[model samples]
Target: MANTPQSKKRARQNERRFQINKARRSRIRTFLRRVEEAIASGDKSAAGDALKAAQPELMRGVSKGVFHKNTASRKISRLASRVNALG
Candidate 1:
C-alpha cells in the first residue's frame, strides 16, 4: 500500500499511465494484426499497404516508449520481408 501522500499520488499516476499504455498497446496490436491478415491472405499489394499504415503507428509506439526502438525496427524488418516475399 502507498502510505505517504506522495506515494499515493505516484500510485495514481502509475495507474493512469498503465491504462493509457494499455490502450496504446492494444491499438498497435490491431494495426499489426491487420498487416498479418493481409500477409496471410497472400495479397502483396494489400500487405504492403497495411505495412505502410502500420509503420508510423509502430514508430509512434516506439517514440512513446510502448516499444523499444530495436524491437520496432525488428518487427518492421520482418514484416517488410514477409511482404516482399509475397511478391
Candidate 2:
C-alpha cells in the first residue's frame, strides 16, 4: 500500500532495481547459453572462446551482486574444466 512517502519511494526504487537486475541476469544467461551451445557443438576452440567471453560477464554478475562469488567461481571452474576436456 505504501502509505508513507518514504515507503512509496522505496517501492519505486525496488521496482527499478528489480528491472535492472532482471536484465542483467538475462544477459548473463545468454552468455552462458552461448558457451553451452558451443560446447554441445563439439567445437573446442569455439567453446573456449565463448568461455573466455563469458568469464568477465559472470564475474560482473558477482560484482554487481546479481550472483554469489562462489556461485560464479564454481560456474567458471566447471565450464573451464569442460572446455579443457574437449581437448
lDDT by candidate, in order shown: 0.97, 0.97
Q: Candidate 2: list runs displaced more than 4 Å.
A: none
Name the TM-score of candidate 2.
0.98
Cα shift from native, residue 48, model 1 (Å): 0.5
Model 1 residue 32 CA deviation in Å: 0.5
Deviation in Å, model 1, residue 37 alpha carbon:
0.3
Clashes of each: 0, 0
lDDT of 1 at 72: 94
Q: What is the lDDT of candidate 1?
A: 0.97
lDDT of 2 by residue, 1-87 (tens): 999999999999999999999999999999999999999999999999999999999999999999999999999999999999997
Give the worst 10-residue stretch by lDDT in candidate 1: 78-87
Backbone clashes in model 2, listed as residue pairs: none
Residues 31-64 of candidate 1: C-alpha lDDT, one tens digit per residue = 9999999999999999999999999999999999
